[model samples]
Target: MRHLIPLLFLAACASTQDPPRGPSLPDTCGAGDYSYLVGQPARALERVLIMEELRIIRPQTMVTMDYRAGRINFKISDQDIITDVTCG
Candidate 1:
């Protein structure tokens, strides 16, 4: 029985999934597609500000961006896991 308890504890500790945190973006944002916004100068500036709030991209950081399904996909540092993104 003691051994079983230790084994269960080890098994529980071994799980690697991160806990759920919160929403991907803020509530105030209404924009839907960033690709076209990237072309417009004013929207680009506003997008940068929103991205900062979302922690999706940092100021002056190099990120490969893509527009997918009305969201700005930001790839930073080469991990498949998306760190941050913003709505278009």
Candidate 2:
């Protein structure tokens, strides 16, 4: 009985599965359409994903890119204006 209990425990542990993941991000982030956001009020955007600098990225909310293909970052001014638009 003792051996069977340990074997069952081991089997249970080995059979456990990892939690399911959420939806995946798109291959292309589609940053080009946001050029109009530059020089506009920051609040004008319904979804403002702000980034202070390119080096500082939020993994849960952001992705790092080797080229300017699939990411758009907005630099907001203290006065709540969008000062810059960049792609990564």
Q: Judging by lDDT against the true structure, name the best candidate.
A: 2
Q: lDDT tens digits, residues 2-34, model 1? A: 779988988998869899888665523344433
| lDDT (Cα, 0-100) at 55 in candidate 1 | 29
- The digit string of per-residue lDDT tens for model 2 on 1-88 reads 8779988978887746788898754435454556677777777666755432232232244554576544566667766777765555
- TM-score of each model, paired residue for residue: 0.26, 0.39
What TM-score does structure 1 among the candidates reach?
Answer: 0.26
What are the runs in model 1 whose C-alpha is more than 4 Å off?
1-13, 24-27, 35-84
Q: Model 2 misses residue 22 by how many Å? A: 38
- Model 2 gets an lDDT of 0.58
lDDT of 2 at 28: 50
* lDDT of candidate 1 at residue 34, scale 0 to 100: 37
Model 2 off-target regions past 4 Å? 1-29, 47-68
